[model samples]
Target: MESPDRTVHVAYDPYVIPGGRTIHGRADGLNGEWSVHLGRQTSVEIVAGLTDGLTRPRSAHAPNV
Candidate 1:
């Protein structure tokens, strides 16, 4: 994890919903399971110009799409 001040390991918890995916704590209105991409590029995009944002490190318990 790279921060503006420094870098550290950050943990994020994500879940799925009907409309779009969510980033647990930082963001809530994000696209849920429907837009989650498994092995391909997804429609979801993180905050622009910001290095710290939602990223798929692993499967979010399978994409509902």
Candidate 2:
């Protein structure tokens, strides 16, 4: 994904095997934030523009760190 608060366009290439379409849209929000899961080993949450804010999500089976 590109930077936030900017317009982005995406197009899927067709004719190779199947078919697809293009999508265009814009987004406006506070800042970018993301949560990623790495298999069943761990999960990570990150707030854009800063690494100090990185963290793991709370879970019933996981102990607080």
Candidate 3:
């Protein structure tokens, strides 16, 4: 799945394959740099929520760090 603006991309694989990655993501940052992320054996619920959040629009208000 990808964001509406095509700035973010994510992939997930639930199958258990040896040395196979479970999740991969690429995003274009505000700083004009690209970021990559990888995950293995991550929880389904967590990945689901991450995908869900990426597909939705961000809030106008900044989040508390």
Candidate 4:
């Protein structure tokens, strides 16, 4: 998945690394700023949940509710 403006991107690829899957990210189209190696023993659902929280929008103040 990517940011709405497309300056940031995150992806998961199992084949890019030899022993395990990876979640890699970059900003401004530059070289990867960071990566998380799931170490061959993680599930897609967990990854999805993580990335969802990572990319989800946020607000400075709490809602009234």
Off by over 4 Å in 4: 1-18, 28-32, 59-65
lDDT on C-alpha atoms for all candidate structures: 0.32, 0.35, 0.55, 0.62
Q: How do the residues 1-65 of candidate 1 rate in per-residue lDDT, one tens digit apiece?
A: 33333232232324432323222223235633322222222233343212243343336785554
- Give candidate 4's whole-model lDDT: 0.62
* Error in Å for residue 32 of model 4: 8.6
Screening candidate 3 with a backbone cut-off below 3 angstroms (N, C-alpha, C), the clashing residue pairs are none
Model 3 gets an lDDT of: 0.55
> In terms of TM-score, how similar is model 4 to the real structure?
0.49
The lDDT-based order of candidates, best leading, equals 4, 3, 2, 1
Off by over 4 Å in 3: 13-29, 32-38, 59-62
Query: What is the clash count for each candidate, in the order shown?
Result: 4, 0, 0, 0
Give the number of the best model, judged by TM-score.
4
For each candidate, give its TM-score against the true structure: 0.17, 0.22, 0.44, 0.49
lDDT of 4 by residue, 1-65 (tens): 66665544555555665555555566445354676777557777887776776566755683632
Instruction: Report the lDDT tens digits of candidate 2 across residue range 1-65.
Output: 42343344334445433444333444437434332322222222322212222222456875644
Q: What is the full ranking by TM-score, best candidate first?
A: 4, 3, 2, 1
